[model samples]
Target: MDFYDKERLTALQAKEEAQWITFAPFVFQATRVLRNSGILTTVEAHRQGITLQELTEKIDLPAYGVRVLVEAGLGIGLLVLSEGKYKITKTTYFILHDELTKVNMDFTHDVCYNGMYFLEESIKNQKPEGLKVFGQWPTIYEALSTNLPDKAKKSWFAFDHFYSDYAYPEVLPHVYAFKPKRMLEIGGNTGKWSMASFAFDPDVNITIMDLPGYVEGAKGKLEELGYGHRISFHPGNVLDETQKFPQGFDAVWMSQFLDCFSDDEIVSILTRAKQALNPDGHIFILETFWDRQRFEASAFSLQQTSLYFTVMANGNSQMYDSKVFLECVKRAGLDVVEDKDYIGVSHTLLVCKPVK
Candidate 1:
């Protein structure tokens, strides 16, 4: 975080960064086309690099189309020209091959691109103005089940799953460490975590609490998988505040769930988690706090993602700073017993109990 505190770049260098913002939309689309049109992949395959005419012949586009994109790619730092040939740069290779980069790009392109135009209005209005691009919904969460475009939905799930898929393997051990026989999973979207739970522990019973839209679908598939006896459903909106968490769970788990609501809502949710918990039960909050990240780039990515929350998500929530998030924990009258950082890709798990 300190790396961002001082003015690290010279006036000239700072101006370049500012210019990148000015042309960001064009750069984003151009780089995306280069990746999607297979221009980078083709250049990558040649190894010795390929000439402008060779790249034109290899790709399906017309000569002028290829020429324009290739030219843009060179300026965008996605390509380097040397000896009359263009080669994919390290940045381009990541854009082409890295799973994280691919997911982020797709999520941005399919879900966030058009909606981002409403950011200034969203911030001023204190609402998700961009979500109107999708449908009439207060937030994108509700729209996820019913209204999102097909490609947007696919990219959204892929983006969501990519992070959790990596985190699950590392997170499961900690959840099962207590040998909890019953667990409550809040915001159990699509039963991805439920499925993971079933595989991780054959004996533990899980009660999934979520919006009505997500819970029913998860219930049916889980039941069809013959997990009928192990998984139960509780569909209710947590923001209603009138409805409380179901009681008597040995461990209450929330994974990538809390960041969906405002800080006040988090305190409300965690307070309910405390009330629902058995005397010795611990609440496990799995979240990505930008400051907790091991690398500055990872931190930067999460920080940028907070804007999506502002303009597209609930408009009230965001990727939290650890200090701000922890203050919410204290406000809920919960004490963090174990603060574990760097869990899997970019998560920090806070183990909390009712304040003593």
Candidate 2:
């Protein structure tokens, strides 16, 4: 309508766009800090003393370029410069450089770095224009595991680091709602969710299923939290464990776990879970689903969700609305009595009951 109204709308839009530009550095800075720190904390660094000259020789970069890189790193507090020598920061030691640490600096550098570059494209396209945008790989995980550079793999280990942030707190209320007796956590890396539940609700017994390697680190996490008694580590493929799963469990939870597969694979998984559940057992699905109708859907929360789908799940990650999810559940012979949005920056929660 009026010029004044149009002017106000344009200003609001401009403000919103500027916020993301301002916030982009925080995202990039974290990745840069983590990546540089990982190198400094490496065992090789300790043995040979990874100075700018050594780093240049090792990586085959120019000496002048290495100096600039190291300087920027030092400026960001990721690298300590003292007595004409370089060292890693404390933040990098535990999270990035400690032996077999959860956070992977290389993965962030490769996967997340590219994802951020396309933020504006994603916002404009209303869908991720990542590698898969041009029909590249089916999923980013597959591409990375097979074709990604070694440096990128170093950062991808950070995938496990994100588990705690994505699943807990948001899913806690739902877990409590079901009041589960024998809880089975599929792909429960580090057992953080299980440990948190076991502490809050002492009556529950939590079974965490993950690959054997991830389970190795989870032991310390469980032991550190004094949850060794209540939590059990079962390492195996989740699809293969359906027959052995204890029947009649009050709840079966898959958190941010399903997007790892295609539609056919998801149906297969859900079908198996349906068979594993008792007549009245419940299943919880939590993930990001894009609402094509809402412009506000392109906000920061949505952007992050799309980026993960590109970098991790490839484009196969569906922002399924309740209707789409319900169809899948019903296809698996489950009935959805309640589906509600969880408390988070973005996404929805579906609570399903097995169909008799």
Candidate 3:
């Protein structure tokens, strides 16, 4: 990525950035509280701005509590003080209203905050040590279906859907270009993509393969939505090296899924996909490779996301650099016949075919 090619910050700026890192946890919680406690929103409602006393009068918080948060907000760039009144900054607007930012923030707070403390342990063990904070599971995927708290589950789904759902509109036509009748979607959580596929294509049938719990949940939801007839399911742990992927689909799709696994696991999954390929059919992989992003902010967010894997998702997997991820794809005995980037928010679609 052109984003991180050079050291751009001055020495003083770099030292300040280091302090930002050092107090990151505090700032993050402070921001969340500001949003949740309606401090940010209250300031937003006052178009001109709200003074500490005025804001406290509008909300239930103690005046002192409101003052400190507003002062902190000033430093954090979430607020601006103009003539003794606190006003929402662009960052505050995004933190309060942006769907992407909201989803990411909620995910980090509700699902990842407590667990992330075990990051070092996870890295050392090469397992999801953070996952134990919720409950014991080999990985976060297992906990997602049954063990996660209500807020945590909601946040996780919101986060996952926010990332991939936006890409559906951009990807469907490209995928349907192959005009495949039957498709297999591994890691098709809640059948959202399948619903998108059905909406985009009149006659295509999809089978979602996932953990038994997710498959069952998706089936119920699809059935409720009157898509049961056109849908099928193959419930199994895709991570199990012994279990071969269900074979012979014209199109195989994975979106924001492969990055959940280590390089070897990703290769194994793709290798199976290669073996099961319909020769004329294609495999579509949609991921946000850190190096392929159009914005430095996006790249920075993704680089930070790698630690989420190292701590919460699975210790060995990460938000990968394109070169590193493609090396895994190459090892899987497939060739990227089509490479498309900038899909939806920030995703790369790699249309692969079995190496001939």
The collision pairs in model 2 are: 104-155, 104-158, 105-155, 106-154, 106-155, 107-154, 107-155, 107-156, 289-319
lDDT of all predictions: 0.90, 0.60, 0.89
- Residues 1-356, candidate 3: write the lDDT tens digits: 56667999999999999999998998998899899999999888989877787788887878888878788888889998878888898899899989999999998898888888888888889988888888878878888878688899999899989888789998899999999998999998889999999999989999898999899899999999999899999989887878888888999999999999999999999999876667788999999998998888899889988888888887899999999999999999889999999999999999999888
lDDT (Cα, tens digit) per residue for candidate 2, span 69-182: 667666555577655667777754655544333343344445565665665565465444555432365445444435555555545545544544655676676668777787
* Top TM-score model: 1
- In what order do the candidates fall by TM-score, top score first? 1, 3, 2
lDDT of 1 at 354: 91
Q: 1-356 in candidate 1: lDDT tens per residue?
A: 57577788899999999999899999999999988899999999989989999989989999999999999998899888999999888898799889999999999999899889999998998798988888889888888877688998999999998998898889888878888888999999888888988998989999999999899888888998889999988889999989978999998999999999899999999999888888899999999999888899999899989889988998888999989999999999999998888888999988998988
Q: List candidate 3 stretches off by more than 4 Å.
A: none
Q: After superposition, how far is residue 84 of candidate 3 from its true place, in Å?
A: 2.1
Native-to-model Cα distance after best TM-score fit, residue 192 in candidate 1, in Å: 1.8
Candidate 1 Cα lDDT to native: 0.90
| lDDT rank order | 1, 3, 2
